[model samples]
Target: MTKHFKSAFRQEVAELVVDKGYSIREAAEAMGVGKSTVDKWARNLRKERNGEETHDTPISEERRRISALEREVQQLKMEKEIFKKGHSSLDVGLNEKFALIEEMKGSYPIKSLCDAFEIHRSSYRYWEESSKKIRPEDLRTDIEVKAAHELSGGSAGSRTIATLVTSGGYDLSRYRASKSMKRQGLVSCQPPKHNYKPANKANITIKNNLNREFSPISPNQVWCGDVTYLWVGDRWRYLATVLDLYSRKIVGFALSNSPDSALTKKALSNAFKARGKPTGLMFHSDQGCHYTSLLFRQLIWKYQIKQSMSRRGNCWDNAPMERFFRSLKTENMPKNGYKNEALANDSVRDYIYRYYNSVRPHSHNLGLSPNEKEGFYWKASNWLARKG
Candidate 1:
């Protein structure tokens, strides 16, 4: 536009001087420009060829610079995309982010891009390999988790859902399952705490043989019992339960109008019968008259079951029992209390047998339901016996 030569002409002149074997002086004379102007043009052409600046560099380098500029712009675009997407790496996950880096591999240096995005190369490599090796069962994990949540009465936590999905033949981890559950707006109901009332002291008490050793290796080895009250038809109805220490399942239960030795003994008798009168079992409870009564002691001796009592006033000694009652009340109790003892008893039966045993997940049981854990143990035991 100015007095300077056009880009096409400059390029041709430079090519004539360098590539076509014409001297700068002769080219300048032939082109009818001053020697100094030709010299300047020649010097600029040389600089451009040497990847240096030129007097006409801005205009002259346009063609050569476009490709590099375009690449730089693309890199800036990719970086901007990374920043936007990196808002929640957990949401996008390492596998997808790694894939994005792989896709832009040629355009930008991998390490540089990863650093810019705060991604570790080692993790990306690991994710790349793992993602490529995903199996059929690995798919639809989120769906399986959602199904598990629904199966848990919309109250299963992420860890419980993970166990449920695994039990259903889907491979999943708790973290991933939690993320999936969060994405699906699945929330587990928070468990309520149990309040303990001091056991009613009677005339006699026994030694704390169980000694708060709640963890037992097998079901029926140790059973903890407790009594709780529920409101029904304007009267207090008592619920007594025996829980297997190993699985925390309500092995036996009895509902009555009175919290007496008869009610406690009835629960013990039910457990003894249902468990096939298993021997060498320990029964643990607080120092209540219902548990420490002469009649209950005689029954324990009849079955030759070891009697274990909690320390005089400590409730944590039989914590699982308390926790069970709390869960029963919090999760199973009717919103407006039962209309009658019959309804209350039926609700207890439904909770212990149908829901708590078979459906509700127990944290101590590794997210397995009481019945499921005990079933697994029995199955494994039988299998081992047969193999042996």
Candidate 2:
């Protein structure tokens, strides 16, 4: 290091340190040398009395890093253009890659720059694809269930409708349908809470003499019957039904204060008048004591009607009739208790005589309502006979 300088260069440096308020460090920053070098030059200037160090400031580390990044970006831009062109000429392979990338971008992250243009991130990385996709809520099942419930007046249980849905060839399981239904809060109306199981039905168990056979060739050939309850105003009102097997039509129906012999009798009486008794006709029902009661047996004998009973707890013995009661409850009964008996009565009446008997399509009867099924068959048979 040198001594003092009273000359121009030293004076200029002194002016910078004094007037510009630059320290030896700041001067080193303004110049291109280390602070020590600048200090050595300043000492020498002070001794020899002249000369400036014309070196520029040192490059910053951050600036160098930014420059390297820019170079990489430019290289990638060129590479992307090349890949895009390469794919432009060859149709299949490149399109497939691009499509794969697009699909993965929406689903998974593009792990690298190569993944953006040339390859799929999914192909490179060991990524897991979750299989638990939630099944969507379908109104079709809802509509089907509601239709069944409406047909039965909300009294039919999930089991019967499950049978219908499965038998109808829909790609669904009744178990699944039942679960979905419960989830959706759809209600089953069959099996009113009260009502005893058929009386000593097992002890007296007759042959499924009915064999669940419900089809009839003529209007008065067969009659099917069942019992269900309705919420009447404040108490329960029970309904007894007699369906003409030939048409599967509601030949007789009676709603009474309770489920008793009188209720069944009224229904039978209405049915008798509705379809004038034909000889050798069959009357089938579950082995309920009401049907076996003296009054019922006497009426059957009086009318020359054949009495048939289903085996105990065996609903399919007279499936068509059992199916009917299921339809009525599901279609009409209010789930929470009927607010008023009169309202329940009105709803049940509308469903049975109006909807189930006439409007809703029954898949078994060639998708025709009972009346339509019978009428069509009669027309066909009559036509065939006339031709013969």
Give me the candidate number with maximum lDDT.
1
lDDT of each: 0.79, 0.64
Report the lDDT of model 1 for residue 254.
91
Per residue, candidate 2 scores C-alpha lDDT tens digits across 8-41 of 4444554465457678888867754467755655
What residue runs in model 1 are displaced by over 4 Å at the alpha carbon?
Answer: 1-147, 176-186, 192-204
TM-score of every candidate: 0.57, 0.51
Candidate of highest TM-score: 1
How many clashes (backbone N, Cα, C below 3 Å) per candidate?
A: 0, 37
RMSD of each: 10.6, 17.0
Worst 10 residues of 2 by lDDT: 51-60
